[model samples]
Each structure stands twice: as C-alpha cells, then as structure tokens.
Target: MRILFIGDIVGRSGRTALSSRLPGLITEWKLDLVVVNGENAAGGFGITEAIYNEFIDAGADAVTLGNHSWDQREALVFIERAPRLIRPLNYPAGTPGRGAAMIEAKNGARALVINAMARIFMDPLDDPFAAIDRELAACPLGEGADAIVVDFHGEATSEKQAMGCFCDGRASLVVGTHTHVPTADHRILPARTAFISDVGMTGDFDSVIGMNKDEPLNRFLRKIATSRFEPASGPATLCGLAVETDAKGLAGKVAPVRLGGGLEEARPGFWP
Candidate 1:
C-alpha cells in the first residue's frame, strides 16, 4: 500500500499549495491513501467546516487535528458530523469527535488512522500510549486493517520519537506534526514502522512557523502582543512523508516530501 501523510496546513498559503499540487501527486505517485493534518487550516488557529470539506475535496481520505482542534468554535459542533475528521484520541472522554477512524482507501483497502496528542509540554491529556494501544489492539494490522497510520502531534521531539518507538511494529507509519519545521530524520525503524520526528507544516517558510514574521518577532523582542498572529501570505511549501507498506502492513520504504515555495524540493525515488 502506498500512503501519503501531509503535515499541518496553516491558513490560505498552505491550503493553496495543497489545492494546486495534491491532485497531481495523487496521480503521479499513484497514492492509495492520503491523510492531512488540518488543525491550523483556519488562519493558523483551527479548522472550520468549509476547510474540512475543502481538504476532503482535495483528495484527503482522512483529516487529523491537534491542540488547535477546538480553536475554531464551530469545530466543537461540526466535528461530530464529519466522520473523516479525527481529533486526539487521548482527549477527555467526552470530547466531540473521534480520536481514530477506519476509512477505505481509493483501492478499497482499509486504513486505520489514529490521531493522538502528547502531554509533554502540551495540554495534559490521557495517556496517548494506552489510548492508541486500545485502538491498535481492536484492529490488529494485517488482520483487521490493511494499514495503520499514527499522527503523533506534539512539541517535544523526545515524546514524538518515543511514540514512534512505542508503536514500532504495530503501525505502518508514525509521523509527527505541530512543529511546523521539517526534520531530516525520515527513516524506517528497526521494527519496520516509518518514523519522522516531524513532517513540518505546509505553509510559508519565510515566516515564523507559518505565521507572519512581525508579530512573533515582536512577541519575542518586547514580550507584548501588539496584534494577532496571522498566517503568512507568501507561497507555501507542501511538506509530508510518503510510505510504501508491505502486505503485512509494515512500512517497506519511507521518504520525505518537500515541494514548492521556499524549501528545497524532495521526492520519493521509488515513485518514479
């Protein structure tokens, strides 16, 4: 199975890049499944119903979220209606949307996507390890699901790496998000799970983590909020990870994808 997992989408710049490039990627790469992290799609705050629909229209089989999942007020209500949208599985028991979802890929293969947030330097949530373990146990890879993908959204690299190691052989891919800066550590783990500390954000790299430079700069210098942090308007670089899974749902090949805008380009060699 060939799968692509895009990093966080921040506002218009990210959305534009994705809208323009995703269709072609779906064809050129012959991707069987696509998942996108869209928690920051709405002006770098939270996703709205429209943006959720937009991602789906752009070819995302499932959309994942992070701490910003509820920044947009409507998300609290709309998430219940959007089955393809997944929030952190470790969120409080009564949290609105689901933490994981089982969706059919383009080829009719089953893919289990689990989105879980880390607690280290992040909002305190339930144990992500246990939360994801329950899901993986319920649907064992190769037995119940053809593929398993885990989006470990967090700030600490250690936590993300730990999650990747924790889920090693159980999941097909374990990629990180929320950092908005792509790392060069995409590799298949000893247990055959594809791991990357962070896949980076799909927004402008010219600014600070996808936000306009001025405000974040000011906050860093004077320590005062003069204005709201807005999403950068410049062109964005779509960032993500591509994985090819074996018949047993273990990752056989993994590569980082960085295209367009400011960052240097990268493509999976196996695709061609």
Candidate 2:
C-alpha cells in the first residue's frame, strides 16, 4: 500500500495548497491511503467541521489532530459524528472523538490510523506509549489491518523519535507533527517502519512556523503580544511523507514531499 501522511496544516494558506494539490497527487502517485494532520487548519488555531469535511472530500482517508484539536469550539460537539477525524489518543478517557480509526483505503484495504500526543513540553496526558501499544495490539498490522499509520504530534524531537522506535516493527509509518519544520531524517527503521522527526506543515514556510512573521518577531523582541498571530497568506508549500508498505505491512520505500512556496520541490522518485 502506498500511504501519504501530510503534516499539520495552518490556516487558509495550508488549506488552499491542500485543496489545489492533494487530489492530483492522489491520482498521480496512485496513493492507496492518505492521512492529514489538521490541528491548525483554522486561522492557525484549530480545525472546524467544514475543514475536516473538506479534507475528507479531497481524498483524505483520515485526518489527525494535536493539542489544537479543540481550538475550534464546534469541534467539541461535532467530533462525535466525524469518524475519520482522530484526536490525540492520550487525551483523558472522555475526550470527544476517537484517537484511532480503522478506515478502508481507496484500494479497499483496511488501514488503522492512530493519533497520539507526546507529553514532553506538551499537554500532560495519559501514557502515549501505553495507549499506542494497546491500540497496536488490538489492530496489529498484517492481521487486524493491512496497514497502520501513527501520527505522533509533539514538541520534542526526542519524544517523537522514542515513539517511532517503540512502534518500529508494528506500524507502517510513524511521522511527527507540531514543529512545522521539515527534517531530513526520514528513513526506514531497523524493524521496517518508516520514521521521521517531522514532515513539516502544508503552509507558507516564508514566515515563522506558518504564521505571519511580524507578530512572532514582535513577541521575540518586545516580549508582549501586540496582535494576534495570523497565518501567512502567501503561497503555501504542501509538505508530507510518502511510504510504500510491503506485503507484511512494513514500510519499504520512504520519501519526503515538499512542493511550491519556499521549499525546494520534492516528490517520491520511486513513484514517478
């Protein structure tokens, strides 16, 4: 199975890039499964139901979230009805929406998508490793599901790497989010799971982590919030990770994806 995991999307810039590029990429790459991290899709805050549905309509099989999952007030109420929209797995017992989902890929195979938040310099939550272990045990690859994708959203690269190592042989792909800056460490682990510290954000990279640069600069210099942080409206670069799973549901070929905006364009060479 060819699975693509898109990183966090910020504001209108990110959404525009996704709307314009995802459908074509799906057809061009012959992708079987697509997962998107949409925690910051609304004004660089949280995702809304409309944005979630847009991602689904654009061919996303599962949409994941992070700390910003509740930035949109409506998300608290609408998440119950959005099956494919997954929040952080470790968010207490009664959090709205699910932390994992079993989805049917475009190729008609079962794919388990799990979203978990790391707790280093992040919101305190249940043990992510434990939560992930339980889910993986229940819907293991090559048995309960044909493929498994884990989106580990966190602030510390160390935590993300640890999670990747912990899930190495069991998951198809384990990619990081929240950093919004693409890293060059994407590779298949010893156990065959594809891993990356971060896949970056599908938003304009010219600014400070997809936000308007002025505000961040001001905060850094003045140490005070003069205005709200807004999403950079410039052309956005769609960023993601591409992984092809073998018969055993382990990752085979892995690559980075960056297109448009300021980043050098990239695509999975194997796909072409």
Candidate 3:
C-alpha cells in the first residue's frame, strides 16, 4: 500500500499549491491513501467544513488535525459528521470527534488512521501513549485493518522519536507534524515502521512555520508583544512524507515529499 501524508496546510497559498499539484501527484504516484494535516487550513487557524471538503475533493483520503483542531467554533459540530476527519486521540472522552478512523482505499485496502498530540510543551491532556495504545488495540494492525498510519502531532523531536519507536512494529508508518520544518531523518525504523521526526508544513517557508516572520522577530527583539501573527502570503512549499507498506502492513520504504515553490529544497518520491 502506498500512502502519502502531508503536513500542516497553512493559508491560501498552501491550499492553492495543494489544489493545483495534488491531483497530478496522486495520479503519478498511484497512491492508495492520502492524509493531510489541516488544523491550519482555514486562514492558519482551524479547518472549516468547506475547506475540509475541498481537501477531500482534492485527493486527500483523510484529513488530520492537531492542537488547533477546534479553533473554528463551527468545527465542534462539523467534525462529528465528517468521518474522514480525525483529531487528537488524547482529547477528553466526550470530545466532539474521533481521534482515529478507518477507511477503505480505492483498491479495497483498509487503512486505520490515527491522530495523536504530544504533551511536551503542549496542552495537558490524556496520556498520548496510553491513548494510542487503546486506539491501536481497537484496530489491531493487519487483522482488524490492512494498515495503520499515525500522525504524531507534536513539538519536541525527542517525544516524536519516542512515539515512533513505541509504535514501530505495530503501525505501518509513524510520521510527525506541527513543527512545519521537514527533518532529514526519513527512514524505516528497526521494526519496519516508516518514521520521520516532522513531515513539515505545506506553507510558505519564507516565514516562521507559515506565519509572518516580522511579528515573531519583533517579539524576540523587543521582548514585548505587538501585533497578531498572520500566515505568510508568499510562495508556499508543500511538504510531507510518502511510504510504501508491504502486504503485512509494515513499511518497506519511505521518502520525504517536498514540492512546489518557497524556501526549502523539494524532494519527491524516489521509489515507484
């Protein structure tokens, strides 16, 4: 099974690049499933129903969320109805939506997608480790589902790495998001799970993780708050990871997927 996982989609530019290039990429790579982190899809805040549908229409099989999952007030209700959308698994029990979802790919392959948020330098929530364990148990790797893909939406690289190692043999792929800067360490873990510290953002690289750099730089220089930060309007780069899982639901190979314009080097798939 070939899967493509895209990082945080920022604002208009990110969406534009995605809408224009994704269809071609999907067809060219012959992807079976595609998951995109859309927490920042709506003007760099939270995803909206319309934008969510747009991503799904643009080739994303499932859309994942992070800390900003509920930024838009409407999402509280919209998310409950959207089956392809997934929020952090560690959220409170009564949270509006689910943290994991199961979907059948075009080729009739079953995939279990999980979204989990890390607690380090993040909001205090249920233990992600425990939350993931419970979620994965609900959909045991190959028997309950054909493959498993986890989006470790987090901050600390160490925590993300630990989570990847934790789910190594259990999942087909364990990729990180939220950092918005693609790491160079994309490889198959010891247990055959495809792992990457951060899949990066699908936004303007000229700014600070998709936000305007001026405001952040000012805050650092003066040690005082000034204006609100906004998403960068410049050219955006679509960043993420791609993996090919074998018949047994273990990742056989992985690659960092970077494309379009912006500040960073874009690397496409190296395997068929």
Candidate 4:
C-alpha cells in the first residue's frame, strides 16, 4: 500500500494547494490511502464541514486532527457524521468522534488510521501509548488489515520520535505533525514503520511555519505579543511523507513529500 500523510493544512492557501495538487499526486504515486492533518484547515484554527468535504472530494481517504481540533465549533457535528475524520485518541474518553478508523483503499485494502496527540508542550491528555496499545490489540496487524498509519500530532520532536519508536513494527507508518516545520528524519525504522519527526505544514513556506512572518517576528523581538497570527498569502507548499507499505502492514520505504512552491529541495517520490 502506498500512503501519503500530509501535515497541517493552514488556511486558504493550504486548501488551495491541496485541492490543486493532491489528485495529481494520488495518480502519480498510485497512493492507496491519503491522510491529511486538518486541524488548521480553517483560517489557521480548526476544520469546517465545507473544508472537510473539500478534502474528501480532493482525494483524502482520512482527515486527522491536532490540539486545535475543536477550534471550529461546527466541526463537532461534522466530525461525528464523517467517519473518515478523526480527532486525537488521547482526548478525554467522552470526546466527540473517534480517534481511529478503518479506511478502505481503492483496491479494497483495509488500512487502520489512528490519530493521537502528545502531552508534552500541550494540554493534558490520556496516555497515548496505552490508548494505541488497546487499539492495536483490538485490530492487530495483518489478519485482514493491509496497513496501519498513525498521525502523531505533537509539538516536541522528542515526544513524536518516542511515539514512533514505541509504535515501530506495530504500525506501517508513524508520521508526526503539529510544529508546522518539516523535519528531515524520514526513514524506515528498525521495526519497519515509516517514521518522520514532523511532516511540516502544507502552506506558505515563506512565512513563519505558514503564518505571516510579521507577527512571529514581532513576538520574538518584543517580549510581549502585538499582532494576530495570519496565514501568509503566497504560493503554498504541500508538505508530507510518502511511504510504501508491504501487505503485512510494514513500511518498505519512505520519503519526504514536498510540492508546489516552497523552501527546501523537494522531489515527488522515490522507492528508497
């Protein structure tokens, strides 16, 4: 199975980039599943029903969320109805919508997609490791599942990497999101999971991790905050990880996916 995991979709530019490029990438890579992090899909806050549908129609097999999952109040209802959209599993037990789901690929391969947020540098949440343990136990690798991808929504790279190692071999891919900056550590772990510290944001790369640079620059220079964070109006970059998984739910190869206009040298896809 070929899986593409896109990072946080910032605002309009992010959506526009996704709408324009995803379909082509899906065809070019022959992707079996596409998971998008939509926590910031709506004006750098949360996802809306309209935006959610746009992603689905644009070829997203599943949409994952981060800490800002509830920023858009409307998502509460939309997420519940949309089984393909998932919030962090570590969220309080009663949180609306589920943290994981099974999405069937074009070839009828069942892929288990799980989303979990880390506690470090974020709000208190349930033990993600334990939460995932139960999930994997319930739907163990193979047995019928072709692949398992985990969207580790987190801030600290240490936490994200820890989760990846913890879930190595158990999951087909453990890609990180939430810092909005792509990390260069894309590789197949010893346990066979395609792992990356952070897949970055699918928005304007010229700005501060997709937001306008002025506000972040000001905050860094002046001790106090002065301006609101706004999405950068520029050519967007689609950032994510592309991985090829074997039939037994293990990653065969992995690479960082970057497209459109953006920073860093990027290419489409490669086997290694």
Candidate 5:
C-alpha cells in the first residue's frame, strides 16, 4: 500500500496548495490512500463543512483533526455526517465524530485511520494509549485492516514518539502533527511502522507556525496581543510523510515530502 499522510492545512494558502498539487502527486506517486490533517483549514481555526468537502474532492481518502477539531462550531454538527472525517479518539465519551474509521483505499484495500490527541501540554482527555490499544485490538492489522495509519496530534515530541513506539509493529504509519514544523526523523521503526515526530504544516513557512509573523512576534516581544493572528498569504509548502506498506500491513519504506513554497522539494527516490 502506498499511503500519504499530509500535515495540517493552515489556511487558504495551504488549501490552495493542496488543491493544486494533490491530484498530480496522487497520479505521479501512484498513491493508494491519502489522509490530510485539516483542523486548521479554516483561517487557522478549524475545518468547515465546505473545506472538508473540498479536501475529499481533492483526493483525500480521510481528513484528520486535532485539538482545534471543535474550533469551528459547525464541525460539531457536520462531523457526524462526514464519515471520512476523524477527530481525536481520546475525547470524552460523547464526542461528536468518531476517533477512527475504516475506509477503502483507491486500490480497493481496507485501511484503518485513527486520529488521537495526546495529553501532554494539552487537554486532559482519555488515555490515548489505552484508547488506541482497544481500537487496534478490535481490528488486528493483518487480519482486519490491510493498512493502519495513526495520526498522533500533540505539542510535545516525547508524547508523539511514545505513541509511535506503542503502535510500532501494529500500524502501517504513525505520524505526528500540531507543532506545525516538520521533523527530520522520518524512518520505518524496528517493528516496520513508519514514524515521524511531526510532518509539518502544509502552509507558508514565512510565518510563525503558519500564522502571520507580525502578531506572533508582537505577542512574544511585547507580551501583549493587539491584533488577531492570521494565516500567512504567501505560497505554501505541502508537507507530509509517504509510506509503502507490505502485504502484512507494515511499512517497508518511509520518506518525507516537502514541496513548493519556500521549502526544497523532497520525494522518495524509490518511487517511479
């Protein structure tokens, strides 16, 4: 299975880049499944129904969310209707949308996509480890799911790394999001799961974590916020992690993808 997991879409810039590039990449890379983190697709807040639909139209098999999953009030309602949209699995019992989903890839293979939020330096949600364990147990990788992708959205690197290790041999890929910066540690773990601390944001790198430079810089220097933080207007770099899984649903190859905008282009050399 050739799977691609895109990082967070910050705002319009990020969305534009995705809309323009994803389809071509899908064909060029012969991707079987594509998952995008779209929590910040709407003005760096949360994704809307339209934006979510846009992502699906642009070849996204599944769209994942983070702590900002509920930032857009409409999400609470629309999420129930969008089966391909997944929120954090560790949310309280009554959370609106599902934390994981089993969707068929373009190649007709079944893939289990799970989105879970970490507790470190963030909301005190349910234990992510236990939550994911139950999900994976219910659907063993090779038997029930041909491919399993875990999107661990969090602030701390340690927590994300731990999640990757926890799901090491079970999942096809375990990539982190939320910090908005790509980490260089993209590699297949000992157990065969593709792991990366963070895949970075698919937005302009000219700003502070995808936001306008002024507001964040002002807030930091003056310790006061006089203006609202907005997404940068420049071109965006579509950042993500690509993995090729074996018949047993374990990653055989993993690589980072950074394209367009200010970042240098990176694509797996093994792919034709």
Candidate 6:
C-alpha cells in the first residue's frame, strides 16, 4: 500500500498548491491512500466546509485536523456530515466529528486513518497515547485494515517522536504536523513503521510559519497585537511524507515530499 500524508494546509497558498498538484500526483505515484492535515486551511485559522470538500474532490481520502480544528466556527457543524474529515482523537468525548475514519482506498483496501493530538504545550485533552492504543487495538494493522496512518499533531517534537515510537509496530506510518517546518529525521522505525517528527506545512515557507512576516515581526519587536495574523499569499511549497507499506501493512520504504516555492524540490525516488 502506498500512502501519502500531507502536512497542515495554511490558507489560499496551501490550498492552491494541493489543488494544482494532488490529482496528478495520485495518478503519477499510483497512490492508494492520501491523508492531509487541514486544521489551518481557512484564513490561517480553521478549516471550512468548502475546503474540506475540496480536499476530498482533489483525491484526499481523508482530511485531518489539530488544535485549530474549530477556528472557522462552521467546521463544528459541518464536520459531523463530513465522514472523511477527522479531528484530534483525544478531544473531549462530546467533541463533534470523529477521530478516526475507515476510508476505502483507491485499490479497494481499507485504511484506518487516525488523527491524534499531543498534550504537551497543547490543549489538556485526553491521553493521546491511550487513545491511539485503543484504536490500533480495535483495528490491528494487517487484520482489521490494510493500512494504518496516524497523524500526531503537536507542538513538541519529543511528544511526536514518543507517539511514533508508541505506535511503532501497530501503524503503517506515524507522521507529525503543526510545526510547519519539515524536519531532517524521516526514516522507517525499528518495527517498520515510517516516522517523521514534523512533515511541515503545505504553505508558503517564506514567511513566519506560513503567516505574513511583517505582523509577526511587529509583535515580536513591539510585544503588542497591531493586527490579525493573516496567511501568506505567496507561492507555496507542498510538504508531506511518502510511505510504501508491505503486505502486513508495515512501511517498507519512506521518503519526504516537497515541491515549489522556497523549499528544495523532493519526491520519492522509489516511485516514478
């Protein structure tokens, strides 16, 4: 099974990049499953119903979310109807929408896509580790689903790495998001699951974490809010991780994906 996990999409720039490239990548890479983080797909805040549907139409099998999952306000209502849109698993029990989704892959296989959020320096939600364990137990990699992908959204790299190690043998891939900067450490774990501390944001990298530079600079320098933080409208570089799993739903090959804008271009060399 070939899986591609795109990092957070930060606004028009990120959405534009996904729309322009994802369809072709599905055909070109022969991807069986695609999951993208869309917490910041709105005006640099939360995702909207339209953006969620756009991701689905663009061939994303499942769209994941993080702390900003409720920024748009409308997402709270629309997400209940969007089966493929998953929010953090460790959210309060009554939180709207689901944490995990069973998506039928393009190849007719089932992929269990889970979105989990860490607690370190983040919302004091339920235990993400225990939540992930429960999901993985209910749907064992090779038995319940052909593939298992976990998007651990967090602010701490250590916590992300811990989640990756915690789900090492149970999931097909464990990738991080929310940091908005691709890390150098992306490799298959000892148990065969692919792991990366941060998959980066699929938005313009020229600014401060996908936001326009001036405002952040102002706040940093003046220590006061002069204006709202807006999404950078420059050309974006789509960032993500590519993993090819084995027969037992364990990752066999992994690579980083970055294209356009500021970052150096990259694609899975194992694929065409």
lDDT of 3: 0.90
- lDDT tens digits by residue: candidate 5, 1-272: 99999999999999999999999999999999999999999999999999999999999999999999999999999999999999999999998999999999999999999999999999999999999999999999999999999999999999999999999999999999999999999989999999999999999999999999999999999999998889998999999999999999999988899999999999888799
Selected candidate, larger lDDT, 1 vs 3: 1
Task: List, residue by residue over 161-208, the lDDT tens digit for candidate 3.
Answer: 999999988999999999888999999999899999999899988898
Question: Looking at model 5, which ten-residue stretch has the lowest summed lDDT?
Answer: 263-272
lDDT of 4 at 203: 93
Candidate with more favorable, higher lDDT: 1 or 4: 1
lDDT (CA) per prediction: 0.96, 0.95, 0.90, 0.89, 0.96, 0.95
How much RMSD separates candidate 2 from the native structure? 0.6
For model 4, the local distance difference test gives 0.89
lDDT of 1 by residue, 35-139 (tens): 999999999999999999999999999999999999999999999999999999999888898999999999999999999999999999999999999999999
RMSD of each: 0.6, 0.6, 1.2, 1.5, 0.6, 0.6
Clash pairs for candidate 5: none
lDDT of 2 at 181: 97
lDDT of 6 by residue, 121-177 (tens): 999999999999999999999999999999999999999999999999999999999
**How do the predictions measure up, each by TM-score?**
0.99, 0.99, 0.97, 0.96, 0.99, 0.99
Clashes of 6: 0
Q: Which stretches in model 2 have alpha-carbon errors above 4 Å? A: none
